[model samples]
Structure formats: structure tokens, C-alpha cells
Target: MVLKTFGWSFAVTALGLVAAVLYGGWTAFGIVAILSVLEISLSFDNAVVNAGILKKMNAFWQKIFLTIGILIAVFGMRLVFPVLIVAVSAQLGPIEAVELALNDKDRYEELVTDAHPSIAAFGGMFLLMIFLDFIFTDREIKWLAWLERPLAKLGKVDMLSVCIALIVLLGTAMTFAVNAHQHGGGHANKAETVMLSGIAGLITYLIVGGLSSYFENKLEEKEEREHEEEEQARKSGKKVTAMAVGGKAAFFMFLYLEVLDASFSFDGVIGAFAITNDIVLMALGLGIGAMYVRSITVYLVRQGTLDDYVYLEHGAHYAIGALAIILLITIQYQIHELITGLIGVALIGWSFVSSVRRNRELAAQEALGEKAESHS
Candidate 1:
């Protein structure tokens, strides 16, 4: 299984390298490969979170996620999205934007740099909202119910997230909208443009994120019902066989994985912007990262790693929460993407080691109990 997984990753990595070479020569290809590893290393937590979602998916959708999802990550989000952002923001036609990117490399870099603050703001706020929603919302977990009880009593309010987003939007607007003289000879109007662009990005995130959350919740509820049904079937002495692929369960699972993938990709895509404004390079690097993440997800499902590492999912979610906060703080500070990635990796790695150690201790305890019974 390990070899098969590695083979798949190797093939994709080779293809990425070849594509980079064809487009931008050996030097460019080398750069992309390095960046890809950096992205993968930084995004290990993403893989863990993705694994939690992918496990609930049926085989067919999981396969689709690995195949078609790669296309979306590599081309749609990484390459096309940036181009679209540039064209729309710079008032250049799509053709003109592409021409500038392909011909005027320096200009392309400048455009992307100019657009970074807004992109960061959008991604940061979107992720923050996700974290806050997750914390406050009730889940099936009994413990969570107790935790959310007070929050729920406050009424049907997701107002905190909304209010936070509004504050961010207002601060951005004010920072950019102030007069130049009042701001001490700075380009007030330009700052305002960046701020307003960020506000637009935040609004876009809210819309998309709200839709994603709604669908995710519905799918999760459906999964819970199926699980309950299976349990009841088992109690009645019926053979509760797993359903075939591509059923209602499978479709919901697919949606769940897609949503999870999007969430995990948020940081990676944003971080890719920090490396190179060349959409091609960003695509190549982040595509490689996405492939590795998918491969890791598949391996976890096949091996039932989540069952073994019980705390792994918890750790990943915690890391996501931390990352969301970090991204928010970064809006006003020069927080490095590498730092963010490394911190997430460290936290997840610690959890993984702890899980392994705990498993070993349990096994030892069980063995000792069996020996004691035999002696009696």
C-alpha cells in the first residue's frame, strides 16, 4: 500500500516537473519542485484534516477527489483564479492580463504583490469565520453539547463571526480611506483601494463559506443517520454490510471531501502567493502539495490510521483553529507563511507521536491482562 501510494505521488511529481520544464526551463522546474516540497511539509496538518473527511467518503468519490480534484486545485484555483483576480482588479482584460503575465514578468510580479494584502485578508477572515462557527456550533458529541449550551442560550446568533468580519472590513476601509496628509504623506487612496478590495474578498468568502458550511452540516447529519441505522440493524441481528459505492452516502461523502479539501487548500494557496507571482509556478508547487495531501488521505483511509490515532483529527482541527488566528494576526504584521506552516506541522507531528505511544501502552496493558488471566 505504501509503495502504491508513493508510486502515485511520484508519477504526479514527475509530470509536474516535466510541465514546468516545458513551460519555463530547467531552472524554473527546479524552483517549483523545491517550493512543492516546502508546501507539502508546511501543509501536513491539511492532510490530517482531509483524512478525517475522506474516510467518510465512498471509494468512487474518493477516487474522483484524487483525480478530478487535482485538476481543480492545480489549474482552476492556482492558475486561473490568480489570473482572474489580476484581470478584475487591475482593469485589464483577461487576454491583456495573460499577455502581461507571460511577457512582462516584472509587471506580473508587481500586480500579484499589489493584490496580496487583499487576498490575505479574504482568506484570513474566511478561515476565522470557519473556526468560530465550528467552536460555537453544536455537534453530535455529548461533550460538545455541554460546551455549546451557554452559547446556544444566547439565541440563534452567529453574530460574533459576523461582527468580527464587519470590524475587519471597517478597519480596512478606514486605514485606506483616510486623507494622505492626515496619514503623513502616504498614498491614502492606494491604501483605500487595497482595503476596499480586501472587504470585497471578505464578502466573497462569507458567501462561499456560508454555502459550504450549510451543505457540510446537511451531509454530516445524513451520515449520522446512516450510522445509526447501521447500528440498529446490527442490534437486530441483521448483517449490516457496508453499502456499495456511489449511493446517497457516497455522494454526501464526496461533497464532504470536496469541502474539506477546499478548507485545507486555503492556506496552501495563500502561501503559494508568497513564493512566486508566476501563476504557472504557483500552480505547479501547490498542485504537487495538493497531490501529496490527497495521497496521504488515501493512505490513512486504507490503513485505518484515524481509528488508530484517535486524537489525530482533534489535533488537526486545533491546528486549523490556531492557523486561522495566525492568519488574522498576519493582516497587520509580516508573519511569514513558512512560520505558519512549520507551526502547524509541529503540532500535528506531536499529536501523531503521542497517538503512537498511547497505542503501544494500550497493547502492553492488554497483553499483561491476558497473561494474568492465564496464570489464574
Candidate 2:
């Protein structure tokens, strides 16, 4: 199972490292390795949230997510997406942006860095929605009941999450504006840019999330009809053919996943620049880590890990909430990537332990009940 599951991830990681060595030598190799580890550590929560969604997909859709999805992730987000951002933000052509990245890396980094506030605002809002929705919705199993219960209660107000997010975004943007005016010397207010990006993020989430929900509902209805037909056919002693999950639902879900991946990547990309300005090295390293994350998502689904660990999803969502807030704070200040990564890992780690404990208690109760029944 291990070989079959992780062979590709290992191959990709090796290939990324080898390319790094061949291009930039041992020092570059070391940098790439560290960046890769940083990406993985920062994205464990991503894997957990991905597993929560990926498990709902059929085997065919799941394979597509692992295969086609990885290409989009590595090339699209890690490589092309950054260039696109630089090109658009700096009012330069894509070719020019690439040249800037290769020849004048510091300038490249500056353009990208200048774009950070907008990126943070957008991604932070998108992720904040995911965290809010997950926490607000009632669940039979909850990890941190005290905190979660209150959030869930507050969730009773329709659109409360969006309302709160807008408020936060406005406040953060105004702060950025103040800092930019006070410090940037005659530059236009940066808060407007941040606010616009945030609004874009909110709109994006609604459109993507709404489309996914609509398609999913349609798929559910189709499945119900097919199930009823299959039951009737079985009653008539007829063989019912297997049906592949329809493409439409999976397509929307696929789009949703990509957006989610982009939002998650924003922080890692910005944080990586603090480590190294070499876009090539950053991409190679983060791409390798991304491949492993994809592998972990598949492994979680295949192993039924989330089903076994009830609190893991809650933990991941909570970690996401922390990350979203961190992203917002990053607009004005530098938060070490180590602190960011540690906060997420700690939450997920504690939740995993809690889940194990819960399992033990349930097992003991079941065993005692069985023993009493036997005696009776």
C-alpha cells in the first residue's frame, strides 16, 4: 500500500531536488530542501481539509484530482500564477515579468511583495469563509466543544460570517492605508487596493462555492434516481450496470479545489520570499512539497483516516481560521513562517490526540457492554 500510494510523491520529490542541484548546485539544493519542508509543514492543514472533500468524490474523480490536479497545482499556481500576478500588478508583460524574475530577482521580489497585501486580503477572506462555515455548522462530533459551540450559536444569523469578514477586512485595509500614507511618502492609499482584492475574494468564494453546491445537489438527485432504478432492476433479478460519477459535479468540485489550493498557496509563496528570492528554487521546493501534500490527501482518503479520526476535520478548520487571521495580520507586519506553521501543527496535533482518546473511551464502553451482555 505504501509503495503504491507514495511512489509518485517520492519520484516527484526526487526529481525536484535533482533539478535544483543540477541548476543551482549544493547550496541551492539545501535551500530547496528547506523550502520544501516549510511548504509541507505549513500545509498539513491543507491536506486535512482536502481529504475532507476528496473522500466525497468517486474513484474516477479522485484519480483526476490527483493526476490533473497536481499539474495545475505545480505549474499553474507555483509557477505561472506568480508570474501572472507580477505581470498584472507591475503593469509588465508576462515575458518581461519572467525576465525580471530571472535577471533582477530583487525587483521581481519587490513587485511580488508589493502585491502581498492584495493577495493576503483575497486569500484570507476566502479561507475565512471556509473556516467560518465549517465551524458554524452543527456537527455531531466536535473537538473543542466550548469554543466551537459558541461559534455555532453565533452562526445562527444568516451571512454572519461574511458580515464579520467584511468588518475585519475594512478595519485591516484602513490600517494599511494609514501606514502607507504615514510611511510611503505621497503614495496613494493602499487600503483601497486591499479592500478591492478582498471583495474579489468574497465574490469568488460565493460564485465557486455556490456553483459547487448547485452541481452537487444535481448530482445527488441524479444518484437518487439511478439508485431507485437499480433497486427496481435488482428486484426483477436484472443486473445493474455501474455508473461513473458524472463529469459536471466533479468539474465544479475540481474548480473549487483549485481555488482552495490557491488560497492556501498565497501565504507559503509570500513567506518563501523571506527565505530566498530565487523564484526557480522557491517553485521547485514548494512544488515538491505540494506533490507530497497531494499524496497525503489521497492517502487519507484511501486509508479512511478522517473516518477514523473524528476530530481531525475540526482541527484542520480551526487551523485554517488561525491561518486566515495570520494572513490578515501579515498585511502590516511580518510573522515568521515558523510561528505560522507551528500554530497549525499544534492545533492539528492536539486534535489527533483527542481523537485517539475518544476512540479508546468508546472502545472500552463497547467492550464492557459486550461483556455484560454475555454474562446476562
Candidate 3:
């Protein structure tokens, strides 16, 4: 099962490293390898979150995600997205942006860095909305009962999550973004750009997430109705057909996953500049890491890991919330990539440990109940 899931990732890693060496010798190879590790560490939470969504998707859609989706993630987000940002921010034509990326990487990196405020704002707000919606929603399983219970109660208020997200966006734009613009020697419209970008993010979240949820719920309802019909037919000795969610639902979920991936990649794309300005190497490295993330998601779903470790999704969402706050904070201050990676790992690790303990307690309770029954 492990090889079936991760075979391609391993092969790609091997070939990518050889290509990296051919491109720039061992030094390039080392940098690419380091960047790959960095991407994986920073994005481990992303794999967990992705697993939660991907589990609901059918096999065909999952294949599309692993194949075509990887291409978009590697090229579209890692390469083209950064260039597009530079082009828009620096007022360069698309061709000129690509030329700059290929010829004068320093200037390219500078423009990308200059554009960080907007990038951070947009990605941060989008991620913030995700975290808020997740935390606000009521679910049967509660990883942090003390916190989640009250939050769920509060979630009864209409649009509470959206309202909170907007308020936080405004607060950050006025204070942190403003200070960043002035103190960082940015243009007069820096804070305004941040504000607009954040609004764009929020709106994007609403449209994409809303549509995705709508279709997913529809699919679930369809499945449920079909399941009921199947059960009735079975009881009556009638033929029962299989349940399948249609392609349209999968398509929207695919769109949502791509957007979610792009939001997660914002920090990594920017942070790669701190390591190296070689965009080719960044694509190769980040792409390798992305493949591994996909593999992990598949493994989780196939193994029923999420079902057993109930709190993993909660941990991933909390990590995402932390990452969103960190992205917003980065509008004014620089944070180490290590710190970001560590926080996510720590949260997930704690959750896994807690899940194990919970399972053990459940076993003990069941054992006690059985022994009592025997005595009686």
C-alpha cells in the first residue's frame, strides 16, 4: 500500500535531484533538497487538511488531483503565480515578467518581495476564513472541548465567522499593514492594497467555498437518498445499485482544493526567496514536496487513519489558524520559517498523542464494562 501510494514521489525525487545536479551541480542539488524538506515541514498540516477533503472525493477525481492538480500546483502556483504577482505589482507585461524571472532574478525577487503585503493579506484572509468557518461549525467530534463547545454555541449566530474575519482583516489593515507601508518605505497605497487584497480574499473564500459546500451537500444528500432506497430494495429482495457522486460535484471540490493549495503555498513561495532566487529550483523542490503531500493524503484516506485518529483534522485546522495569524503578522514583521514549521508540527504531534490516549481510555472503559457484565 505504501509503495502503491508513494512510488511516484520517490521516483520523481530521484530524477529531480539528478536534474538539479545537472542544472547547477551539487550546490543546486543541496539547495533544492533543503527547499523540498522545508516545503514538506511547512506543509505537513496541509496534507492532513487535504486528506479530510480528499476522502470525500471519488477515485477518478483523486487521480485528477494527483495528476493535473500537481501540474497546476508546481507550475501555476509555484512559478506562474509569482511571476503574475510581479507583473501586476511592478506594472510589467507578462513577457517582461517572465524575462525578468529568467534573466535578472534579483530584480524579480525584489518585485515579488515588494508585492508581499498584498500576497500576505490575500492569503492570510482566505486562510483565516477557512479556520474561522471550521472552528465555528458544530461537529460531533471535539478535539478541544472546552474551546470548541463555546465556539460552536457562538456559531449559531448568522455569519458570525464572516463577521469576525472581516473585523480581523480591518484591524490588521489599519495597524500592521499601515505600519508596514510607512516604515518599510512602500508606496502610499500599500495599506489600501492590503485592504483590497484582503477583501478579495474574503470574497473569493465565500464564492469558491460556498459553491463547493453547496455541491458537496447536494452530493451527500443524493448519496443518502440513494442509500435509503438501496436498503429498502435489499430488504424487499430487489436489486440494489451502487451510489456514485456525479462529476460536477467533484469538479467544484477540485477547484476548492486548488485554491486551498494556492493559499497554503503563499508563504512557501515567498519564503523560498530567503533560501534562493532560482525559480526553477524552487519549482522542482516545491513540486517534489507537493507530490509527497499528495501521497500522504492518499495514505491517510486509504488507511482510514483519520477515522481512527479523530482529532487529526482539528489539529490541522488549528495549525492553519496559526499559519493565518502568522501570515498577517508577517505584513509588518518577519518570522522564521522554522518557527512556522515547528508550530504546525507541535500542534499535530500533540493531537496525535491525545488521540492515542483517548483510544486507550476507550479500550479500558470497554474492558471494565465487559468484566462487570461477566461478574453479573
Candidate 4:
């Protein structure tokens, strides 16, 4: 099972490392290795969340995710997306941005870092919406019942998640404005930039998430209708076909996954510069890590890990929430990537332990009931 799941990831890692070593020797290889580890550490929650979505997809769509989706994650987000951000933010052409990245990495890094506020605002708000929606939805299983219960009740209020997200954006924007005012410089443009970026992020989430949910609901309804027909057909001694997610639903879910990956990658891309500004090494390293994440997602789906450890999904969402808040906080203050990665790992680990305990408790109860039945 391990080899089946991780074979492709391992292959990619070997090839990527070989290319890195050939390009810049051992130093490049080492940087690539570190970057790969960094990406995986930062994106473990991403894999978990992805598993929850990908399981609903059919085999064909799942293969597409592994193949085409990996390409987009590696080249689109890790490579081209950053450059696009630099080009638009610095008012330069795409070629100029790429040239800046290749020839003047320091300037490139500066431009990227300078654009952090807006990036943070956009990605932060998008992730915050995701976290908000997850916590607000009523679910039978609640990891943090004390908090989730209240949130679920409050979720009944119309657009509560959007409202809260907007309020957060407003508060952060105001804080930025206040800081700029106190500094008494021409830095107030940052406040406006952050405000606009946050709104854009929120809107992007609404459009993408809303469409995905709509199509998913339609798929479920169609499944239910077909299931009824299949039952009737079975009663008539006819063979019933298996059900899979429809094309439209799968496409939207795939789009949602890509956007979610982008939001998760924002921090990693920016944080990677702290280690190395070489985009090639970063892509190679992060690309290898992306493959592992995809592999892990597939493994989780195949193993039914999420179903076994019910609270794992909750933990992943909570980690995403924490990461979202951290991104927003880093707009003004510097946060180490180690701290970011640790928070996610710690939450996931704790949830896994909790799941084991819950399982034991459930087993003990079942054993007691069986004993009573046997006695009777």
C-alpha cells in the first residue's frame, strides 16, 4: 500500500534532486531538499482537506487531479503565480518580472516582500472564509464541541460567515491605516491595497465555493434519484450501474481545490525566500513536496483514513483557521515559518490521539453491550 501510494512521489523526488544537483551541485540539491520538506510541512493540512474533497470524485477525475492538477500546483502556483503577482504589483511586464527574478533576485524578493501585505490580505481572507464556513456548518461530529456548537448555532444567521469575514477585513484594514497614520509617512496606500485585496479574496471565495457547492448538491440529488431508480431496477432483476460524481460537479470541485491550494501556497512561497530566492530550486523542491501531498491525499482516500479518524478533518480545518489568522497577523509582524509549520503538525497530532481514544471508548461500550446480550 505504501509503495503503491508513494511510488510516484518518490520518483519525482529522485528526479528533481538529480536535476538540482546537476544544476548547482550539492548546494542546490540541499536547498531543494529543504524547500521540499518546508512545502510538505506547511501543506499537510492541505492534503487532508484535499482528501475530503477528492474522495467524492470518480477515478477519472482523481487521475486528472494527480496528473494535470499536480502540474498546475507546481508550475502555476509555485512558479508563474508569483511572477504574475510581481508583474501586476510592480507595473512591469511579465518578461520584465521574470528577468527581475532571474537577474536581480534581491530586487525580485523585495518586490515580492513589498507585495506581502496585499497577498496576505487576499489569501488570508480566502482561507478565513473557508475556516469560517467549515466551523459554521452543522455537523454531527464536532471536534471542539464547546466552540463549534455555538458557531453552528450562530451559522443559522444569514451570511454570518461572510459578515464576520468582512468585519475582520475591515478591522485589519483600519489597523493598517492607524499604523500608517502614526508612522506619518506616505504608507497609507497600504491600507487601501489591503482593503481591496481582502474584498477580492472574499469575492473569489464566494464565487468559487458557491459554484462548487451548488454543483455538488446537484450531483448528490442526481445520485439520490438514480439510486432510487437502481433500487427499482434491482427489484426487477436488472443490473444497476455504479454512481460517480458528474462532470460539472467534478470540474467545480477541481477548481475549488486549485483555489484552495493557491491560498495555502501563499505563505510557503513568501516564506521560502527566507531560505532561498532561487525560484528554480524553490519550484523543484516545492514541486517534489506537492507530489507527496497529492500522494498523501490519494493514500488517505484509499485507506479510508478520514472515515476511520473522524476528527482528522476537524483538526485540519482548525489548522487552516490558525494558519489564516497567522497570515493576517504577519501583515504587520514577522512570524517564523517553523512556528507556522509546528502549529499545524501539533493540531493534527493531537487530533489523531484524540481519535484513537474515542475509538477505544466506542469499542469498550460495544463490548459491554455484547456481554450483556450474551448474558441475557
Q: Which candidate has the top score in TM-score?
A: 3
Predicted structure 1, TM vs. truth = 0.76
lDDT of 1 by residue, 342-369 (tens): 8887777777887788789989999999
For candidate 3, write residues 1-376 as lDDT tens digits.
8889999999989998999999999999999999899888999999999988888788889899899998998889888998898899889999999999988998888888888889999999999999999999999989999999999999999999889998998898888887663223454446788899999999999999998878878777678888899999999999885454448888888888899999999989988888998888888888888888889988998898998999999999999999999999888888889999999999999999999999999999999999999999
Error of 1 at 141 (Å): 8.6
- lDDT, candidate 4, at 109: 78
On lDDT, the stronger of 1 and 3 is 3
Candidate ordering by lDDT (highest first)? 4, 3, 2, 1
**Which residues of candidate 1, in runs, are more than 4 Å off?**
22-25, 136-270, 273-275, 368-376
lDDT of each structure? Answer: 0.66, 0.87, 0.88, 0.89
Question: If scored against the real structure, what TM-score would every candidate get?
Answer: 0.76, 0.92, 0.94, 0.93
Which stretch of 10 consecutive residues in model 2 shows the poorest summed lDDT? Answer: 177-186
Clashing pairs in 4: none
Candidate 2 error regions (>4 Å):
180-188, 222-245
